[model samples]
Target: MGFGDRWRQWMMSCISIPKLSVLINGSPTAQFGMERGLRQGDLLSPFLFNIVTEGLSSLFQKASNLGILRGANCGNGVLISNLQFADDTMLFLEPRVEYLRNARRILRCFELAAGLKLNFLKSRVVKVGMKWSKSNVWADALLCKEGSLPIPYLGLQLGARSNMKTFWNPIRNSIKKRLAPWKSKFLNKGGRLILIKAVLASIPAYYLSVYKIPAGVANDLEKLQSADGKFSVGSFRIQLEDSISDFSVDHKLVWQDCCPPKVEIFNWQVLRGHVMVRQVLHRFGVVQWWEVSSCLTDSIKTWFQGWHGLCPSISHRRVWDTLFAAVIWSIWESRNQLIFNGEDPSLTQAANIVKFRTALWFKHHGRGSKIPISTMLLNLIESCRESPPKKKIQKEEELIPPFSLGLKFNIDSSARCSPGDVGIGGILRNLLGKILGMFSEHIGVYDSNTAEMTAIHRAVTMCAETPGLIGKDIDIVSNSKVTVSWVNANGVGSLKHSKIIYDIRSCLISLGNSRVIFNSRASNSFADCLAKKGSAMEGDFLSREFQ
Candidate 1:
């Protein structure tokens, strides 16, 4: 068939829809007809888009077979025709007239079938390892403009040398634009500080992820920020030693933790008698506050009452603890604003915010807590007493080991020395103690704590990946006191391996049914043996053999 004949045949095959009423403003204004296509803002737009684009994949596959289209062979001998993310598409093709013509034809066919038009004028063709004349000819044949190298895609330069000065200009210019308005004399110091923290400081972070900031650029930015002598409140990398030294005078117990580096710097200030917190308790006079303020004054509230106020019989222990945590969180947040952002610090304001936030956090986390904010603030003690009744929990005997309904994994790790060649091992069992799975890995030259952590991390991962195991109540048993504490607390410390902690916590939180608990080394003998075996091995191994 001829070209006109084929075009007519394709156009005649297109379907048209019946008349539909169109609403302009509030009233029906006209009747119109449109072919059935994917609706704008529909949840299934991406899925439908992929479905429509599947035709391109098939066309390109046939073209590859027919020797009409060629894509760059990226090492493993596999050819890549296109890279797609959401609505953005980058097509890779040999710079040739026939390929360009075929591409245009395929796109036109797709537009006819899916009723989604592609505007060639808006599209740009980028060339790589091709002559300028050849690339210009390809762009002309495709009826698209030639695009420059290093086009911005997904907030990153697609083909730019990341280390070059030109690559950083965009980020530098963006920061300048953001900081310009904040430099006005009309703006207050507090408002400027907020803008600087929120907007100016964050402008370059996206680009910074792609390339390290040069030393000169870093110094220039610091000069622009002019943040000398200001308290850097939000940084996770606080110099704890210097901070503790400053707060340590006359307060002997301020720096007390079994693990010294585990405690955050700001938390030590709000511990008990330090940082004007004594006056805060007196002002609020909430029973929970007063009870824990024994260090502030001897006669105010007893330590025993504070320590054992919420027995196992009380279901509101979580709620009460959340309230205390909310208080500290609010205090810290307020302190940041006051010191760093130039807001005047008020203990009363902090306490008031605590009460408000307590209600919000409790309602969100307490599984439908209906206690009103007014009641919580007015009679905080009574509100705690009036929480829902505690559910009766099955009491496990001290002699009998705790049983989980789904998978139970006893994990252990050992290093030849404290920081030497390490190995991790775990054995999975069901409720009846029949072994279901086992794993062992020699993770080279990590400390004992890291080795222990890796054991639990690998166990949780195995449980997640194994068939019929995900979303099941998986108990991870460990013998190390530090490891159990770290995992049980969801690794909420300032110690090293925060990235791993974040990853493991995210995984566990997603599972929702996973739990970490301590078990005696005697109880975890099999897993311990497997760890010793792993220490002798070269690498990782997993066995699904049930015993």
Candidate 2:
């Protein structure tokens, strides 16, 4: 589930007359408008075979060139699912959603002009933090920042999750990923034949039987494999160790599905405390222009701007605006604390009166207006009030899927209390209390939402890549109601929190079109407990094996 997502790329060079049909479009006579040429004894369509071979040959050449050729810079964006075939590429990036309509239309125009049309339903835009993943690799796992994620490429959701259904999904999807390496290693027509057989044999019977996987239905494949194995899918069980020879139909047909042992999971968390004093700063105003107006030395004034993520290398106007905003907000907050607490205030009492006068002079002479100061004050308080209070929130709502199943998919964010890092935990179990594989990870934090968002990104990726985490319906436990609601809904959140909504949507799509629920924190104790295992959330982790 990294940048390349381990896609199945077949550079099919030579194809057999009959086999090519099943490999790509399945019986071209019926599928490709070619029914007129088929007869009971007609030789396989040599014409189709020739056309396919040439295409595969050309595709392999591109792929081979790609090995030595550094791929194009999709820019500060992610490249995901292929548009139609293996050769087509999907790319993404971020920006605001308000402009998305225009962007999509523009993209559509270029797509048509570029000889490829985008499958709109398959393309997307996730509203994320302005700088989310700006300087990093696809953290298959993410530590998303607060606000929305811009999944600016295909509509395929491209974010994170904190649920097990998404986290362990790859294990379920392993059969497909397993064949990826084999296919890429040999793209020739003869090699593709062997690849097809290996792929056919590699599918998980449980995956097929229950039809939870995108592959074949389990019951039918079971009949083809064994007479006794033909049980109802509802009653079928997956035994990965079962050999193909057990089908009772071959001279020593020893075959194993191409599943690799799962990689052991490792956990990491961020440090405690914020790099900036947001709370104290909040006690002031959001924008502090007054500081620039106050009497301060040029050196100290310059130092402040650098601390708040402003580039020192910008133009004079840019630098002043940066420092101006910081100072105004800080001074405004100072005035508020004093006014609210009934403390005395006097700019005249400062020892640095000379600098204070310089600061005041800069502002008075400048064409700036803090006239909306009262209005701004009202907005800041509302913003702070809307954030779920840190005193610990535990509210129970009606249980829903991806957590509605009797088996619990516990989810909780650790970074809420602990600074810098956060963690998410998920587990699936049967009524018998046997623990199916449980997954948990610590995500570094950029904001309160970042950790929660990272958890979400992981969840979606996990469920999409793995199988058996969910079947029909399941329960998903979480401490964050906002996140659960956002994921379950078919659309984005309201204007204020749309970005978070968008990012969550991108990740949830991989759940293969299922509805997940938001349960209270207490109900999600298993995940909550693990997530709050605190900053000590180090080392390889798995739940204590349950009976």
* Cα-based TM-score, every candidate: 0.33, 0.25
Tell me the tens digit of each residue's lDDT in model 2 across 1-547. Answer: 1223233122121221222132445534432323223433444444444433343334433433454112233546533211223344332223323223333444455556444455544432232322345323222113222333323223222343313244224433564455455544543346365555555456554333433432333433433323221344433433422433243212111111111111000000001112134333544665444333325534332443344345333223332332333344445446667778876646644323323332333334342234233432333222112223356654432232243335545556676443455666666555444555466665555555556655665554555455654343434455677766666666664454577667556545545344456655666666666666632466535453332
lDDT of 1 by residue, 457-542 (tens): 88877666665776778888888888777665734752675666666777787677888888778778778888887877775784
The segments of candidate 1 whose C-alpha lies over 4 angstroms from its true place after superposition are 1-46, 65-68, 71-80, 83-90, 115-119, 122-127, 147-155, 185-188, 227-547
In model 2, what is the error at residue 288, expressed in angstroms? Answer: 86
Superposed by TM-score, candidate 1 places the C-alpha of residue 335 at a distance from the truth, in angstroms, of 57
Consecutive 10-residue window with the lowest summed lDDT within model 1: 253-262
Clash pairs for candidate 1: none
Off by over 4 Å in 2: 1-407, 416-419, 494-513, 538-547
Q: On a 0 to 100 scale, what is the lDDT of residue 242 in model 2?
A: 49
